[model samples]
Target: MKIGYIRVSTAEQNTIRQEILLRDLGVDEIYIDKASGKSTDRPELKRMMEYVRYGDTVIVESISRFARNTKDLLELVDKLRQKEVEFVSKKEAIDTTTPTGVFMLTIFGAVAQLEREYILQRQNEGIAIAKSQGRYKGRKPIEHPDLKSTVVQWRAGEITATAAMKRLDMKPSTFYRKVKKF
Candidate 1:
């Protein structure tokens, strides 16, 4: 079986182009996600991986669609290899079933790592400069004034976690995350 995966950073982004391209490659199925590339907790991506069987192939528009960072991309490919699954990237024109493709992927992983490191370095430099100029301001904290009351109610056994989450209008993860920082 041949499966395709498509991903975009936001709900506003379109998956049509990627789907069309994957279809052209004769993919038997396509999985999609509207989430940031920076996040590893992609539910759709996890589902796609779980759906694959031995000798099944996974296709994507490019490495970027599969992963944002080199570590993630490399690790995912390694896992797929263990499953006897082949990975194909249309834009890269590389298929993991070939030795040459393995070589290319290694190089690509190195480049991606270097790119990530460079970006982090530049960000650090910019932060230092901004701090030196007394203009550095860290990210603003999430605020939900009603969250405190809801948390209190939940803690006091007046409400369930679900009730507190509903009252606060936040997802379970969001509620827990905010509660931790709140």
Candidate 2:
């Protein structure tokens, strides 16, 4: 069986392109996760890992889509190898069925991780330059119509912090930070 794995960083991102590519490649099964590839904590990824059996081929669009770092990429491939599964990356033209392909996969994985780091470094530099030019500001503060009333209730112990946060539709960090500012 040819099993495809697809990932997108956020829920808003679309997986249609990857899906089409996998489908075109005649994949028997596909597991998709609309979550960052920064970690292997994704539900679909875990499920796919468990679902794959011996003699199966695991296919991905690219090494980066499978894992953001070389360590993770290598670890995942190693796990697949242990399970007697073959690994293939369409974009990188990598196939772990041969010695040369395994070597190329490692090289490509390292390159992908380096590329990601470079991108982050460039973005941070651009943000710094924009800040110095007074063109960059942090994210705008979130406002709620009943923020004051909710805070008051929270402070008076009328509601739990979690409840107050839920009512305000704010994350714990955001709720605490905003409450502190008040």
Candidate 3:
């Protein structure tokens, strides 16, 4: 079976392009995750790992979609290898069943990791410069209808944290952080 995997970093991003491309390639199934590739904790990624079998091929749009760092990429590929599964990256033209592909994958994964590190370094430098110039305001606070009232209710035990978070359309972490500010 040829299984496809697609991912985008944020909820706002669409996976349609990756899905269409994978479908065009005639994959038997496609799993998608709209989460950061920085971690392997994504639900669809876990599902894809459990769903593959020996001799199955996992196709991804690119190596970066599969993993953010070389360590993670190699670890994932090694896991697939142990399961006798072949990995194919469309953009990279890598088929892990070949020795040459394995070699190229290592180099590509290193390059990708380096690229990410450089991006982070540049972003930090830019933020520092902006801050020194007194123009670096972080993200603006979100406003929601009755947000303060609802938070007060939650804090007073009139509503469950879960319910409050749902009402605010926020994750637990964000909700708790907001609670602290209130």
Candidate number with greatest lDDT: 2
Would you list the rank order by TM-score, best first?
Answer: 2, 3, 1
Model 2: CA > 4 A from native: none
- Summing lDDT over every window of 10 consecutive residues in candidate 2, give the lowest-scoring window: 173-182
Model 2: per-residue lDDT, tens digit, 9-102? 9999999999999999999999999998889999999999999999999999999999999999999999999999999999999999999999
- lDDT score at residue 147, model 2, on the 0-100 scale: 92
| C-alpha local distance difference test of each model | 0.87, 0.96, 0.93
User: Total clashes, candidate 3?
Assistant: 0
Measured on C-alpha atoms, candidate 2 has an lDDT of 0.96
What global local distance difference test value does model 3 have? 0.93
**Residue 45 of model 3: what lDDT?**
93
Question: Evaluated with TM-score, which candidate comes out highest?
Answer: 2
lDDT of 3 by residue, 118-140 (tens): 99999999999999999999998
lDDT of 1 by residue, 70-174 (tens): 778888998899999999888878789889998887777667667767988999999999989989988876577788888888889999999888887888888
Off by more than 4 A, model 1:
36-40, 69-71, 134-136, 145-157, 160-162, 170-182
lDDT, candidate 1, at 45: 92
TM-score for candidate 3, please give it: 0.87
